[model samples]
Target: MLNIADTLHDWCRAARPFALATVVQVSGSAPLPVGTALAVDGDGNVVGSVSGGCVEAAVYELCQEVLKGDAPPTRARFGYSDDDAFAVGLTCGGELDVLVQRIDPADQPHLTAALGEVTSGRPVAVAQIVDGPEGLLGRTLSVSGDGSTEAGAGGGEEWEAVAAAQAGALLRAGRTGRVEVGGDAATCPERLSVLVHTHASRPRMLIFGAVDFAGALSEIGRFLGYRVTVCDARPVFATAARFPHADEVVADWPHRYLAATEVDARTAVCVLTHDAKFDVPLLRLALGLPVGYVGAMGSRRTHTQRLELLRTAAVPEEHLARLHSPIGLDLGAHTPEETALSIAAEITAHTHGGSGAPLSWSTGPIHRRQSAAR
Candidate 1:
């Protein structure tokens, strides 16, 4: 899918006037999450999706209305029931609230710059006054990774300070949502609800194996928007041709490679080389790192042996607890493709704090705690 910034960059470069429709709020099993956007240009070209395929036509019409000035920057709601007189409703049984606005570069300078930063692979957050007085409607302010503001109109320095601080916090969490903030001190009654949307760099997934399962998992990881790298000590097996989906293929010892490479809080390390010499050292380093996930694929017996080696290596008890040995969910997966699915599903569940239980036995919101991005 094309990201919001990609859509904006394409339209701006083409000098096209378009309307951007964003799903700013959703309730009850909505197809898409907040920050999902769809752009429609004057030529009726559509890019991106919000609500999957259920409400695009309705949103497209709303975009045209905003582009034609028939509607001001407006919030359109779609409910599950078709009982309403409106021509469109979400058949998927959910509620979606979308904000449609014309993207005029001359008027939305900060948004333009924010889009550029996003397209250039820099983290940025755009805070838009979604609800407030008429004068503040459609106003936006953006903050980049280095704590620099894109500089736009919203309120006085006080308001900017609060909003920028909030934006920075949300950026760190990679969260997007509405936050209530008061206007200038003198106009305390002038409250505003700002929607802070954060765009962060894609997370990384390092798979230390060149096996068939590693290849399948690499493809799945890339599909999930992760930068996947496949590394193995044996050059014969660690060729790019073996793992076509991987972003990088390195013919190096897993432990030596990880010692020199960068692993952040968003990186996932998969130790698939079940050989004791290779996986033992690799996993010892992986578990000690602050990476988001560290999984090693092996059998129950192999895992028991590996654990003994890690303990002998003096890996802290808490760090050993972080390892997902005998990796992947209990899906009875016997094939490479199915095993990949199980591993990827486990990683996703871990990342989102899921129970790995069936939805039939689940309750509460289907989406994760935080809203999804475009």
Candidate 2:
């Protein structure tokens, strides 16, 4: 699985055989989502998790069974039991459909290559036949972001081609889900259910300031699985030592650095430099970009002044409205750490379309289905 690709690749390179238990489907309020995987090697060593400790021991035993030579690829389901509190199931009132399959680098070369691509930060997707005919079970179709595809041994070429195309579409959308293939079609007679798992590079978090708040925000960004970069015009303040959590520290003008950096719809831009000289140019450009979030830190008075300056500079009213001036939610935060939390909360709420209100005040489900692009 891409979540633990580095460790799996290491085990693979060492010629160690292992069994992977992947969560193919989830129902109800589950802790983990689909494509979450747990791997167990021949020596009883484990690398990843499927249910976040709720059903790990049972999955581990399933992995051991899969590791046996005579074992075939299998599926197992775990859910809460109203009558049996001691039963091996999820106590969180959720259901997980897990597929256990043995993986040997020599046998599953496509999977090994996919794992390597994931570790190298390249986009890759893998489609595995989780439910299908006995002969098709465990067969895989690997698709790269560049449109290249490979199929495992012993599957109908037409079926593999269709599966590969579906995998590529899911990969482009950055989603991990299921696709129904085969069955009374021209491709193949046997019906098959495939789980397509996409592995994309981490989203970017561009923090445009070298202040203490920027340092704290960078730490939170990294914890949220972002590839954080801190940039500032002041070379002395932008040193890596000042922001140890940032993946990159650039001593360049914020506007210039942002102009040269690659950003997508998932990128988050934070302008912590409240000064007019830095904030005007940077916020002007950031608000016009296609990034998911663009927030600037400042007081109400400063925000009014910045808006006037931007308006004078010919920035459109629509673009100016996109700016989250005086950034972060109203958390009554004063310390840098608490301020970072507020900013992170705002960014998350924006990304997930949350109301920025307390969950207790809402009546609907706590978790909303996220978009594939997110």
Candidate 3:
């Protein structure tokens, strides 16, 4: 949702005006969420997806109309109908309501500022429509890195400010929250409720081996939207040309670099160095912290040897268990890139609270539906 907002915000800021289409309501099993958006530029390019592909063409037509100023930002209704059995909407036969808004730069100060921060790789919110419909679909609550804020809700400033602050925190943390903005609790006329979806900074992947596997992880991490970091004790392999995709190629020791950051559940640490001398101590340091993922590469025998070494170094048996040795989900990959894919997949599963189960084997929650209802 935030990604779509950022793109449209860019379109508006550049004064290259675009049409913003968002799924405002859904009934039954929805293919997309209420806040799902897609931006259609003046040239008809799409930046994001709203449905599986169902309403994109229809939405495109609406987008053209919006750019021409032929229509107000109105809620579009589409569902399965008796007349159109072979309809232009979801094959799942769900109904969706899309709100197409023509964003004006003059009216969207808060959204513009928010997108500027996001494009600069900073976390921010582009809060839209909690109330009103004319510009409600474009109304914004934007905050800066230092927490200075601005919003267009004049008379309802305090309530909107509080909602924006709470929503901004959730956005910075990369999650979604529903907030109620009301001043008079006894009997408030305008209750500004919001479903704020956050746009967060990209997760970091710190690969602790500057070897062949580290090089591969760096490339794969780029596709996974990670700020990839390759670290090693030896400076030779950490050269820029070797891991060009990496955001940082550090020649520093793995343990030393790990000490500098608060490794959280969003950060992934891969110990590709199999040498117990370099790898074992680093494994202890990684699992000892709150990092999201800890993958160590080796055969089963090699893992056993590494585990014993960790124990001798005073790392608890339970802590050793946290290491994903013979690392990666069982995709049976042998090549370097394939192995990197398996490891990255495992990292994604770990961070998102997934069990790494096959989709076919999984019953409900077939995929993590990116929606407000979830």
Candidate 4:
């Protein structure tokens, strides 16, 4: 699966066959999301995980069975078992539907190509027939970010096209989920269920000031799987040596660099300049963009002044409300590293719709199901 693309690609390049068990669906308090995978090679080597630690032993045995060639591509379900404590199930009281299949590069060229795209950092979605009629099981169709598609051999051409289109729609939204096709009068006559797993590029985290705080934030952002970029007008402050963890250190005007960069709905824009000349113009542009999070570093008084300045400059009230000025949670953080943690926590809360309160103080499900748009 794309989640462990690098290891899978390496196995493929070495002409090794492996069995992959991917989580295609989840219900209740599942710890891992769909698209999570576990792969087992012929030598009994394993990489990746499906449900943290629970249900892994069962999934691993399934992978081994799949690699032994005795079993065909199959689906297995695991859930909590109250009647039997020794049962092979999840302790978290959640359910997962896992699809186990073999990946041999010589036999599955389409999957090899898809894995190559994922390891190369290109956006791609692979739709596999998880459930379908005979001769259609394990059929795959890969859709690239540019809208081009390639279907694997064997399966009806009409079904392949439908799967490709569905994969493309899911890729555009950067989501991984299942789609039911066929059996419909408008599409195909046979019923088929496809699981589309999208491998999108890492979301961007644009830090608009290259200060001590920026250095700390760049590390945290990278750890959180963001493509971090630190930008500032001061060349001395924006050097690569200052923020070694940053994917890119740009010595350009904050607003100019931001205007030229690519931004999407998943991108997070953090303005740490704290200066009127840099913060005002840069934030004015960032607030208008369709980014996920836009936070600025400042005190209450500075935030008040910045708001008045933006209002005077004709910025809309709706856009202004989206800004998280006097940024970060009420963590009482003093050091730069602590401040970065506070900011990251705020951004995560915003993204996941958390109340930013302590878990002990909150009731109900600890893990909320995030939107597909995320």
Candidate 5:
């Protein structure tokens, strides 16, 4: 799975044989989404999780069976409800389709190459034949954004092409899931299901101030899996020693650097400089871009003044509406750590399409759309 590729690669490098159980599909209210994995080594060591602790024992047992050669790579489904006969069901009343397959030490070298792409901030997709003819089971192929591919043994050239094409399609769209391939005259001619899992680099978070609050927020952003960059015009304040958690520290005017930066819909821009000269120009550029979230730190009075300056600068009303001034949720935070937590919470909610409402006030599946699979 993409989330555990680092751990899996390490195990392979150590020449340890392991069985990887991946949740390939789900329905109803599931505990985890597709591409989630749970691995068990020969010594019974485990890494990552699939069911948030609900159905791990069952998945672990299945991994053990695969490790012992008692079974081939197999697809399994688990479902439980309040009235089910078996006691082993997701407490959330969801169903999960899991695939368990053994990994050999010889396959590690090939896999490590793919992992390198992911850790180096490139987009990659790994396609595994989870269900098909006997000969194709457990076969895998990885495709990166540069159109390079890596395939495991036992896969024919024709099948590799088909899988790579499908993986490339998903990679372009930045998606992960199972796709039906083959059955065509030029290919295997027998339809098969391939689980195409994609791994994209972490999202970017650009903080436009190097204050104490910036350091705290950078730490929280890193913990939340964001590539944080702290930028300011002052080099003295924007030092690696000052903000160790930030992935980069740029000593340039916020507007000048952001104008040349590439941002997609997943990028978040936080204007924490709080000065009219810096905040006005930076917000003017950020609000026009197609970013996920754009928030500025200021009091009510300061926000009001900034709005007037933005309006005078010809910023559209629609763009102005996208700004979240007086940034962060109303957690009544005063300390740097507390304020950082509040801001990170707001960013998380915004990225995941959450309402920032209390869970007790919400009703429905908790994981309704928590993952990128959908």
Candidate 6:
């Protein structure tokens, strides 16, 4: 979480002793992902969380010891079993591997380097492994960097190497990946989960259109935490005054802007330019690449028209189907902001494979609010 990052930065600046407790592994319907984080200070103040109120107290205690230099950084496990009914275990019957370690503000130039990349709105991955006892507990390893890798703490031919390498790859992709180690397939023994966090500071949202809905969508997109860009050729309406929330107001044609940026699988492009002149070309550009979400604002009839245009443009129907036209879900949203929420909801649904249905109508585990923070 950003709070953890900021806190860590401030603590480092103040020369206060602190340790980071990161949830590096999760199993069997866990509440958080592999990279979910929590910070424990010397005074026992906590920021962020690793589990559903099950592991914090234990991890925090470890933090105190780490701060006192009485305990070395290392990996600790928490899970639920019938035997651990009142122990430091998951009440939800899941498992997590936490790496708690003391951070030497003096030796944290590497962390601050990575943090610098993040603060500048760039993406960087930080990898560390805490296993075994203190003294040699958690070691930071360098796997990749656009420039050079600063030395991390761990290295070996078996579990450590595999863990660092896999985590490095995931960080480059800005993703979370799981690694099973030891000679079951490779390595020496057991499985080690490497949590790779690719910290991309601000996400960009590209909107194509100069319509009223475009303005509304831009505002809503900003609300949903996007660095909104309203790109349209018409200078008349693509002004900052019209869509005040947009971070950038570009009076350029859609195709030109699309070609300029690296709008890969993480960017969201919404084509509110319903006319063929804009939508068709923009759709071709959108479909040609792998944007995270491609939404076109139009009715069912307009969607058909766009499809026809695409077909005539020799765009594949398979690619054409990727566009979510009549864009949002069937929420019957009439107002622009409401429609924007529906579209955002649909985008979330598409990305996470949620059904966009009520929670009571679903089965299995009910996702808590904390889990959604990740």
Arranged by lDDT, best first: 4, 2, 5, 1, 3, 6
C-alpha RMSD of candidate 3: 4.1
Candidate 2 residue-wise lDDT at 82: 89
Q: CA lDDT, every prediction?
A: 0.82, 0.87, 0.74, 0.88, 0.86, 0.72
lDDT of 6 by residue, 14-76 (tens): 777677888776676568877677877767778888886877888888777778774766778
**RMSD of each candidate relative to the true structure:** 3.6, 3.3, 4.1, 2.3, 3.4, 4.3
Error of 5 at 293 (Å): 2.0
Candidate 3 deviant stretches above 4 angstroms: 1-10, 14-19, 24-35, 40-48, 57-85, 92-97, 130-138, 153-156, 176-192, 308-321, 370-374
Error of 5 at 237 (Å): 2.8
Better of 4 and 6 by lDDT: 4
lDDT of 2 by residue, 1-374 (tens): 77889989988888899999998877776678778899999999998899889889999988998898858889999999889856888787778799998988777777788889998889999998889877678778799989899766654466788788888888876678788888866886778888888997788999998999999999999999899999999999999999999999999999999989999877999999999899888888888898889999999999999999999989999998888879999999999999999999999999879989997897744556434322
TM-score of each model, in listed order: 0.84, 0.84, 0.80, 0.91, 0.84, 0.83
The residue ranges of model 6 lying beyond 4 angstroms of the native Cα positions read 1-3, 28-30, 52-55, 74-95, 130-137, 142-147, 153-168, 180-192, 367-374
- In model 2, the runs with Cα more than 4 Å from the true position are 14-16, 69-72, 120-122, 131-134, 165-193, 308-321, 362-374
Best model number under lDDT: 4
Query: Number of the top candidate by TM-score?
Result: 4
* TM-score for predicted model 1 compared with the true structure: 0.84
> Per-residue lDDT tens digits of candidate 1, residues 244-363?
999999999999999999778789999898999998888888888889999999999999999999999988899999999899999999999999999999999998788999998977
Lowest summed lDDT over 10 consecutive residues: which window, candidate 5? 365-374
- Candidate 4 per-residue lDDT over residues 198-239, each given as its tens digit: 998888999999889999999999999999999999998889
